[model samples]
Target: DVAKGYILYLEDISVSFDGFKAINELNLYIKEGELRCIIGPNGAGKTTMMDIITGKTRPDQGSAWFGQNINLLELSEPEIAQAGIGRKFQKPTVFEQLSVFANLELSMAGEKGVWTTLTATLTGEQRDRIDNVLVKIGLIEHRYQDAGSLSHGQKQWLEIGMLLMQNPKLLLVDEPVAGMTHQEMDRTGELLTSLAGEHSIVLVEHDMDFVRSLAKQVTVLHQGSVLAEGSMAQVQADPRVVEVYLGE
Candidate 1:
């Protein structure tokens, strides 16, 4: 039954701003433990979709669900965050003054207040998790370094490490490799690929090369709804998708 459950699901979702429909009758689903890439042109409603799922924006109509019965539309933003869903925005927002290790430690679940977690000691289990996350994110060597001192790409990796600390069931990542070098992009591809089977991921990215490297199911969004869905090859071959995206 593992494959029968949907980790994230939306039905007839719509969002509008001043009479302009940002997301019009959007319907999408993500399977558990699947890494799905979402690519779209500007105003394609990618951000609006993430916003609705994360509780930042409520839809005008339709239902959003986490798992089977959990209604995403009824929950507040913090409630959604606590319900095992994690999101990483395009820009990295690490604590510049804190060490990489400290940032991850602070991001762990429980007692999330700034001053309280900063002063609390990590239990053995917490330490182990942080250590493992550092390794997984390829930041063990930089664990003690000031997060502000890292390069743009390194900071992105560190932010991802912070997300791992919570052990969320699903992660929504946005444009993770925007400004990285070729080497950094490849490493990021490897990192995201390694996390797929264990964590369901919905990534919004514009980098076709990076998306191709991941080689998973790709979804193309146009005018606020799905225009294409399948392997990258199939999506590229779709004339409608080609005209709106690849052809550009």
Candidate 2:
């Protein structure tokens, strides 16, 4: 019953490193086509939780499910990825020497082998998809520019666009707006919000303003478990949340 209709679910999940319980008896659920925001001060098991869901780390106890029938805990990292869960790291990993369009072309769904990838040709649909993603991320103007020449914010959007090529069922984005201009932050918020109903998104971000702007539901993690869950306004008003952030 862990999954139900959730795109992702964790029930009584616990994990340890040495003697420290990184995640203890954690329970979380994310509905299909919903964008969920997860926030915490630091070491609240956010990364650990993502690792567990992606099968990069196995939990010491409890269950993790992807959709209705997929047992994420039983799958390996590659298998989890192939199952339509895409993860973006805190830093952009786009090919700096490649043009934005080329980078996206390289990310299209198919065999990733070097020979096959380099020789593959994009069909009409794939080209249209890339063009649409370019517009969505607001990188249409820079489509032909080398990734190295773009601003940090543009690079981030390009990386996100690369992820879009996979047509993932769920997107796990980490600190997406960490380094960017205020204008870029607002645009990034818009980009993420636009993807909600089409693709379930799980964002781990420290930017309160950005979270407030984009998050419909916010989950606060402290001491490796949920301290509160609500809208940004509701959670900010919670005395427990205030205490945790202020160390009171």
Per-model TM values vs. the true structure: 0.95, 0.96
Instruction: Please provide, for model 1 over 29-113, each residue's C-alpha lDDT reduced to its tens digit, 9 standing for 90 to 100.
Output: 8998999999999989999999999999999998888887788989999999999899999999999999999999889877668
The superposed Cα distance between candidate 1 and the true structure at residue 56, in angstroms, equals: 0.9
Q: What lDDT does candidate 1 reach at residue 232? A: 93
How many collisions per candidate? 0, 0
Each model's lDDT = 0.91, 0.90
Question: What is the overall TM-score of model 1 with all chains considered together?
Answer: 0.95
Q: How well does model 2 score by local distance difference test?
A: 0.90
Q: For residues 153-203, could you state the per-residue lDDT of candidate 2 as single tens digits?
A: 999999999999988999999999998999999989999889888999999
lDDT of 1: 0.91
Model 1 clashing residue pairs (backbone): none
